[model samples]
Target: MEKKVTLPKHKFHIQAGDTVVVIGGNSKGLRGVVKEVIVEKDRARVEGVAMITKHMKPTASNPQGSLVKTEGSVHISNLMVIDPATGEPTRTGRKVNEKGKLQRFSKKTGNFIPDAYRKQ
Candidate 1:
């Protein structure tokens, strides 16, 4: 008998440092850079995307319990890549520039991602 191997599905195409816009959920229309990508869970944490307040229980670390506000992870399906030039959400595609450098650009804005963090 032959053994069959199954692989998991990966949905989100965006990677860390990529600016994305929230397309669905409670935080719809919000734009932020991807801080982390949880590929196994099909979720990505976007900087300043999902904000939630939690009550922390005091422990040895802190004698006082307090309310904390933190960013929450969003499903990859809810996010769309944002164009660096126009600041609008768009699909990402790679192409070689005049200098033969590989560059990613927004299909909607027709502009390449900023050079500062484009390497990632």
Candidate 2:
């Protein structure tokens, strides 16, 4: 019988829809919302960050070969949650309220980050 090995967990507490800022790499200082979280791999793809160009070969979907630019995944360690109050990058922590609803807050500003993006 083959045994299944569990993947290591990620330290990042971020989830899909959370706004984040790139802290390292060429895309440093760029801010975008989390589009996908690859928890198993400890990476997250942020919208409008770390874009890379891919040369697509001619296919039935598109007979014309072209270059397509798309977002690339970055390690979770390179991202920091955006603080709603300060509008700056900050770490996030999870807490449970009296109502028992799990909420994420900014460690820097101590502000509750809404699940949805706050209107700018």
Candidate 3:
């Protein structure tokens, strides 16, 4: 018998497509767009960071195996979302707008972050 694996829903301040800066690890000081949010693993795949090489087996697409480069996930704790308003790193906070809609804001500048996923 095989055990079933389940992924828990994780609410992360940083979402996909948000620009973030690495605060720790070898990728520290580097910035990139958030490609994906790995909620189950508590990590995020940032563009141009934590690159790794993978060897692939020969397939119909290619006659020979090839080495492919891809981005690996960085722990969520090591990332800081960049505030578009200030063009700098900032901590995120949640607030209810005048319309009673939940909004994400930058703690440093006290500015609301425009989120596409959330309808206003």
Candidate 4:
């Protein structure tokens, strides 16, 4: 017999399409747009960073296998979102705006950061 429990999903500071800079690992100092975030693994795929070689097996479309170079996921902990106001990497915070909707903000500048998927 075992007891099962469920935990709430973690709220990550970084999101897709945000401009981020790699602070750690071999890709340190590299900057790119975040392509996707893996909530389960707590990793993110950044454009043009963490290049990896993948060997794809031959498929019906092609007879020969192919070696594909693609971007690999980097841990979210290694990424810092760039501030839209100051154009520099900075820590982020979440707070309710005047509209009563929660949003992210840059700690360095105290400026509100707009959501990447949302348009005003």
> All candidates' lDDT scores?
0.81, 0.84, 0.90, 0.95
- Candidate 1 residue 109 Cα shift, in angstroms, is 4.3
Q: Which numbered prediction scores highest in TM-score against the true structure?
A: 4
- Candidate 2, which segments miss by more than 4 Å at Cα? 1-11, 117-120
Report clash pairs, candidate 2. Answer: none
**Poorly placed runs, candidate 1 (over 4 Å):** 1-11, 95-103, 114-120
Which scores higher on TM-score, 1 or 4?
4
lDDT per residue, candidate 1, 1-120, as tens digits?
999987866534587888788999999988888898998888989888798899999988888988998888999889998776776788877888878987777788667665445554
Per-residue lDDT value at 20 in model 1: 88
**What's model 4's lDDT at 70?**
100
Q: Poorest 10 consecutive residues of model 2 by lDDT?
A: 111-120
Q: How many residue pairs clash in each candidate?
A: 0, 0, 0, 0
User: Which ranking of candidates, highest TM-score first?
Assistant: 4, 3, 2, 1
Candidate 2, residues 22-120, lDDT tens digits: the string is 889999999999999997788999999999999999999899989999999999889888887888888788888656887788888777777764452
